[model samples]
Structure formats: C-alpha cells, structure tokens
Target: MSIASSAFLATIPSPDRGVWEIGPFSLRAYALCIIVGIVVAIWLGERRWQARGGTKGTIIDIAVWAAPMGLIGGRLYHVITDNQLYFGEGRDPVRALYIWEGGLGIWGAIALGAVGAWIACRRRGIPLPAVADAVAPGIVIAQAVGRLGNYFNQELYGGPTDLPWGLEIYRRVSPDNPAVEDPLGGVAINDVPVEVVHPTFLYELLWNLGVALLIIWLDRRLRLGHGRVFALYVAGYTAGRFWIEIMRTDPANEILGQRVNVWVSVLVFLGAVVYFVLARAKGPREEPETLRSPDDPDYPDSGDGGAAGSPSGTAESDTAESGTAASGDGDAGTGDAEAGGPATRPGSASSDVDTGDDGAATENTASTENTASAESAPAAGDPGAGGPPEKPGSST
Candidate 1:
C-alpha cells in the first residue's frame, strides 16, 4: 500500500463528537450532518427545478410532501434489518421509532423517498424522472457525511489485518465480565477476548464521496436520460457495500458463505443496466414548450395562444376582412336598380339595368334565398334576406 493508505489504515483517528449538552438532552454530530445535507440537497434541487422551466413553486411544494416520507422510510429500514435487537426480550419496540438514536437504512430511504417524490412531482405536473436525476448526486454526497457520524461512534469497522493500517482498539472490561482484556483492547465479554475491527464506516464515506464526484462529472459531461444516474448510484453503492460487508463481522445474512449484500449488489447492477437499455428504447420523455422571457416581444399574453407577431392573429384578421367584403357584395347584387343599379347589362334604358328588370332580378334572388335558407339560415334576429349571418365576427 502507498504511504497515505498505510497511514490511514494503521492509525485512523477517531473523529471528535461535537455535541451540545443541554441538561439531559444532547445534540450530536450525526444529526447536524444529516440536517445540513438535507438543506443543501433541497436548495440545489430548487435551483435546478427553476432553471429547467418548471413552475415557480414546484420544489418547495414537492419537498413539503417528500421530506416526511423520506424520514419514515429511513427509520423503517433500520427497524426491519435489526428487529431482533429492538423487539425481543422485553425491549420497548417503541424505542425503535426514536430515530434520533441513529438507526436508518439507506436502501429503504431511497426506495420509499422516491415514491414520495414521485407523488409530489405528479401533483405538480413536474417530470418525476428528471427530478430524480437532479437529486441523485446530492443524495450520495449526504450519505458520505452520514458515514462520518458512524466514525464518531467508533462503529461499522471491518476484519483485522496487519497492513500497518489497522485501527487500534483499546480493550475495556464489559459490564457482564470484568476479568478480560483483549490484545487489541476491545470490550471484553464474559472473560473472552475481542479485538478492534476495521472501520467500514470510513471506507464507505470515502467511497461514497468518490462516487458522488463521479456522478457530478458524468452529469455535466453527458446528457444522460432521466433516472439513469440514480440507478448507477444504487448499483455503485451496492457493489462497494458488498465488498465491505465481506471484511466486516456484521450479522447481515450470507449466501454460499458470502454476504447476502453481495447478491444484492449483483442484482442492483443488472437492474441498472436493464433500466438504462429499456429507457433508451422507449425514447426520451417529451418536454413542455418553454416560454420565452416575459419582456420579449414574441411572448404570448392574455387572450392569445401565441405571440402578437405570430401568423395566427394576422390570418384571422385577414379572413374576417375578406368575408365581410364578400358578404356586402352579395347583398348589393340582390338589390333593385333604384337602390344601387348594376353598371353593365344589355337592353337597359340607362347604362345600368332598367329598374323593372332589376326588380324582377331581386324577386328571383328572394325566391332562391328562401329555398336555400334551410341549409344556411341566419341566427335569431332575421335581418338580411337569407345569407350566412353576414359572416359573423366580420369587421364592418
């Protein structure tokens, strides 16, 4: 191993626990880290949501729904995994609900939190998959900080190895057995020896940090489909956890002498691959048309589907003008010569058609109008003798 790695492994310094002790109640580093992570994630998500042309209040609206669900999911995961410790032997199972004591599962948090977020997005009409992509990197980074909390507790370490990087474990007398001292100075149990194990928490912290960086880099460089980056995160973390679980003495189940987490890693990795492939086949999700700036002359305003400069308004105006002129000409043509004589006609006393012949023409037009009125009758108040309502909405 390199010098830095050797030093990190040989003597990993236990991080200091920054606590605020107010009488009996004590605030801890773990809680603070989680809160900071959540705040930062929400801020970032909000900024991205606005940048993407989403509604003004979408982020805050969604967070109101998603936050509580995430907390519940995280606690539920811990309870399910370590039920034996919480529920058995006269233990108050209600204490399991006390999340301040630090019991949360990342898997459950992500899964159920996603459900909550999805619901929120649906309510707001925001695209759920796109929001997932925006939040993925932030979630991984928060997880990295959470791991440091584990470090302060001096928990979640791995197996022993003389690689000059092994964390020292100072042995202590157990409450039940006060007559044993381990070589590595671990807490003794019934006069038995137990050495200090590896710090898996630190390993996970560093791993998650690296993964977070990788995700940010990929997102910036490539236009990945929605939810793909989050899938990769799941697969990546699961793979790392699988390896670390092998080196640790945790009571997580095993399959074929290997930790059950290993199989989970494999399955998650495969799932990521499958999800990406299917998503590509289905094509990209349709995005809504983004409106230009309000100040732009081309921007749509009240009572219009498009900008004033657009062709729709102009076309409608032109059609109205033409229709009005056509209707007026038709009306004039049906009148007698005395009202408005036609300038051209054979056998006329004046250059215009004779009033008698014009009257006869008017009578014929009135008869024809009554016959065709069945098909194109005007609305309520009968004004002109039968023609389509002088082309309604036409400008005079």
Candidate 2:
C-alpha cells in the first residue's frame, strides 16, 4: 500500500518533473536554471564593472570565453569524482557526455573558468582583481539560482525531517534508463507518497544570498580591493558549504571520514582567508579613473591623451599645459619666478622686507635681482663709467 494517506505534514514540495520535451526539442529545467543564472550574473557583473570604471561590453566578452569553460570544467569534475556513473563495468561510458541530465561541481567550474577569464582579461588589459571584485556578489547570487535546479531535479536533499518547511520529495526515476532506480535515493516509499526531507538545496540558496549581501555591505563599508572581496566571497561560500555538505545524505566520495566536498570547502576557505589578508597588505582600491589593462599601455592616465611612448605622456608636459592653464599663469611658478624677480620686488616692497616662510621666496627674488644688477654695474673709475661723470668737454 502507498503511504500517501499515512502522513500529514506542512512542507515545501519538489517539482514533479524537471524535463520538458516538445516535438523534436527537449528543454531541461536544470539547464534552463543554469542558463538564467549565468545571464543574471553577467548583467549584474556588467553594472558593477561599469561602476568600477571598466569599459562596457568587457563583461560580455569575457563571459563568451568563461561560460563554456566553466560548463566543461564543472562536468569534468562531476565525472571524475563520480566515475561510477560511466567508468564501472556495467555503467555506460558514453553517458558521461550527457550533461543536461545534471551534475556540475562548483569548485571545478571556478578553477577552470578563471583560466578563460584570465585569457580574455589579458587581451583587454583589465586587472583580474578588479573584475573579480565586481563580479563576486553576482557569482554568489547565480549559485543561489542554480540551487533551484537541484530542487526541481529532486536531488541533493538531506535526511528525513518533519519540520514545517521541510521538502516533500518523490521517487525519482532515472532519465537515462527507466529500468534502474536513481542511485541517489529518493523519499522512502514507506514514509509516504511524499516524504519530507531537509531542503539542503534551499538552505544553500539562502546561504549564498546571505553571503552575497554580506559581501556587498563589506565592500562598501571597508572598501575591500586587490581581489580581497572575491576572496571573501570564496571564504563565505565555502564556510556555508561545509555545514550544508554535512547535512546532505548524497553518496559523495569519502576522505578521512568526511565527504570530499567538506574537505575541499575547508581547504579553499583557509586559502581564501590567507589570500584576503596578504592582498590587503599589497594595496588599497585601484584608482578606477586611470585603470589600464596589462596589454593596453597607450591608454591615457590623464585628461589630455598622449601615446605612452611620447614625451607628451610624461607628467611634466601635462602639468605645464593643464596645471598652468588652470592656475591662470602663462608661465608656471619656476619660470615666472626667474623672469619677474626685479619687476616684482618694486611692486611688493614688503616682499623684500619680510623674511618669514611666505616671504622667503620674494626675499630670494629681490636678492637675485640685486646681485645681477651689481655684477652689471660699471667698475670704480674706469673711463666712461663709475666715479663721476666727466665734464663733457674735458678729457679726464
């Protein structure tokens, strides 16, 4: 007898099916969820990137490389860790190629996706740290959305529970081979037509959302930079993943009496913490106005554009032009000081008299003029010059 009538509990219910087939095309909820998450991440990341002074279209371009790389990496990690699905004697090896059915590891996705992002960023000359900081919160929220796919797929839930908001799960039949039951257990038939399980996916979704908010708040308050905000995102996500992994009853590989993911979470979290501390000591937030990617040296650092190799690019030229103009002086301080010394001394008599800090420059100007005039003055009684003007007709 089915257990549907044996129990009554207030709880969240898992979707009946996550796959939809139309005519010749099949649309999967899992894949759709992942796609939506990626789109949202890019949209949010672009906004944040622009706010950080990064050029538009940069995020979209990077995503072109990153998204595919992440999918491949995520699938690779899942297949490698769960090789039984393909590598075992009775298991079909080609089944590993079918990614739409579900399974993607977050760690592998991040690690390999970084490689693609680095390649794209190098081409654009945008600093990876700056991009990472901008994209961190968006990435977390994307993970939150990805968890919804798991709920739809009826996967990754925890042990039986009777909580008010517990997830009511159903028996899941394998999409690949209907003859075999899903290796990952579903709700016990004895428990009910629907049995409540701890909604581990939902817990993770909420956790990721919370972590994203925490990062945004901290980024604003402390002004974290040098990829520290990204590191914090990693640490924060892994911290939650550790506890959540423990609650999950899924048959993950074991290491030292814990799930493989648990160990990964701990190690990654520690590395993130260490990196955050070290990176902060490296520097403050980058001045966004002058941001230049590694490959684009010709990018201007000031208002008046100049080729990096040109003399005009040097600070001196720009200062002479803009700084002098802004100060309303044709000749900047040094040039004017030299030329107008004698002329200026007569106008500001106190300029010569005063010897305090402010007046020191004026005193120096007057002294310089006096020295020049003395050197040019006629020697004592020599012919046409000094002692007395000779009587015009007399040859002294």
Candidate 3:
C-alpha cells in the first residue's frame, strides 16, 4: 500500500451507530457500556474486599445504594453544569433526564455516591474507609470501561489532527430522515472523510487503566488503609483528568477562562492529597480480625464462651483438656493414699513415689498444683488473654 493510503487506513474510525433496535425496543451502546462497567466494578470490588478480610457480598450490598445514587449525582452534575443545553430558548428541558444519551460527571458521582455508601456501611457496621480502600482500583478500572460509551456516542473528541492514529469523525443523520442530524442517535451515511480528531476519550481510557494498576501496586506495597488507597486513586485520577479535560473540544461550562472541570480537578486533587497525608496517623493496615464490628454476625467473639475457631474458643478447649488430665491425676493420687502406697506425680512414672512421712501432705499439695495448672493452661494457650481489649472499628 502507498504511504499516504497506509497512514489513512491506520486512522481509527468511529462506530457508525451507537444504538440498535431489537424488536420494539431500542438498545443504546452507551447504557450497555455503563451497565457492563458497573458489573465489572462490583465483581472486582467483591474479590478485593474478600482479600482484605471483608465478608463476601458486602460490595454488592453497598452497590445497592451507591449505584443508583451515583447515577443520579452524575446526571445532576452534568445538567447543572451545562444548563444551557436543556434550559435554553429552543432546548427541551425533559432531555436532561435522558442519561442514556451520555453525560456524567465523575466528581459529582463520587461525592453523592459516597453518601449512599456511607449509609450502607453504617447499617452494616463496616468502616466506610475500609470498603473504599478495598474498591479503589476497581473504581478506576470501571471508569476506563465507561469511557468506551463516549467513544461510541461520538463525543468528547479533541481538536482536528492529521496524526495517523487520529479518530475519524463521521457525519451522522437519522436513518429515516437524512435531513435531521442526530449525532448521538444516527448512522454514518458515506465513506467520504469529514475531519479526523484527537481521540481524547481513548487517551482517558488508557490513562484510567494505568492509574488502576498504579493504585493496586502502591496499595499492595504500602498496605494502605484508612481510605489512603481511595485517596491515592482520587489524586491519580484527577491528575489525569485535568490534562485530558483540557484537550477536549466538547462544549462545557467554563470558569475564569478555563473549563469548570479543570478547576474541579485541581480542587479535588488537593483534597485527596490532604486526606492521604493526614490518614498516616491511623497507622498501618488494620488486622482482619479488628475490621469487623462486634455487632457483625461474622465477628469473632472473645467472651468467656468465644466463637468457634477464635483464640478464646481455642483457649477454652485447651483448658477443658488440661482440666480432664488434672482430674485423672487427682483420682490416681487419692487411690494411692487410700491403699497405703506411695503417691506419684502425674507424668513422673519412672520416678520413685513419695513414701516419706509427708506423703499425705505431698499428695494434697500435688492435687492443688494440678488444679492451678488447669487454671493457667487457657492463659498459656491464648495469646490475647489478659491483654487490652480490642477497640471496635469506626467509619468516617
């Protein structure tokens, strides 16, 4: 192939359509991408939470609240920021509710979605920070996946470019009515070129994936807790979004000659940084045992009768065994005294029995010692015994 032709061929082409009609229903690619992203995030979050000693299905439980609230928050942010699109003289306000058409703000989603998560966490008696830390990487990966929706919708592109990898922007119109332009709900009609532009959405998707990996690596290495991992994720994401947001040619609200999102990115990044630094006082990653609240069904009780397989439970079992052995020794010692024979200590079979004048006293003393040994066995077996009580974990 000729060099010019090869270069042109290498350019990325936009999808001809972002929606499909199946029977009487219209399925939107943007909505499918969002749903897929949510599923992936939940799946990954559950695994990560379990790895961090959280109960299974906790992520799903939290998502029941977070997901819906997040969607609402994202849509609200988009509408309020770009009010001109819906509330202008010729625009229709009802279209603001059409989320499938695309437009969600990460900042607002995180802000309000956190409120929902906080409610679920409180109800479950789990620390919100712990859950946030566990799901940090998953959230970033979900964002990356969601960016595919923007690409299919033929939005969020940057200024025109001649680069070999530049994205080809197609002129789309309604299939049934060619005169009516429907950028988000139309099909490309010709093979002729209009203009190739910088694929900003692709750039963001790649960046988000890189951030997810970075967060995972840093979290594993540092054993981040107290929401430090989440803070790191926010900082990392905002850093990338700041630059990517600047590259987009899409119409958006601006503040002080710069896009409002750029300002939001700067503010959010600083907030994340501050939180990450302050969280150091919380010490290292929490012990799995300490993460659960006493009210949690899965919590290990350390009372007189502890939960099965717990340290206190093990100690109690060991104590019972020790007491049984002591009782057997006591019976043997009594039998020897009654038969006018020398009494031997337990586990001292080879040694000569006590036949001295103090024989009765020795048997009594040995019996007392055996009782003491039984009492001390539990303490020896349980490492946490007599230590300070464990404090219950709390959330912000």
Model 1 error, position 356 (Å) = 28
Worst 10 residues of 3 by lDDT: 387-396
Q: After superposition, how far is residue 177 of candidate 2 from its true place, in Å?
A: 9.8
What's the true lDDT of residue 250 in model 3? Answer: 94
- What is the lDDT for 12 in model 2? 80
Q: Which candidate leads in lDDT?
A: 3
- Where does model 3 exceed 4 Å of error? 1-7, 293-297, 302-304, 307-396
State the TM-score for model 1. Answer: 0.64
Per-model RMSD to reference: 12.0, 13.0, 8.4
lDDT of 2 by residue, 312-384 (tens): 2454434433333113122222233333232222223433322222335444243655657433433212222
For residues 1-396, what per-residue lDDT tens digits would candidate 3 score against the true structure? 665445569799899889998888989999998999999989999998888887888899999999999999999999999999999799999999999999998888888999999999998878899999887888888899899999889999999898888998888999889999989999988644478899999999999999999989998888999999999999999999999999999999999999999999999999999999999999988767655555556676533333433423355443333222223223433333333433343345333333333544443244665446333322211222233222122110
Model 2 regions more than 4 Å off: 1-6, 173-194, 290-396
Worst 10 residues of 2 by lDDT: 387-396
Better of 1 and 3 by lDDT: 3
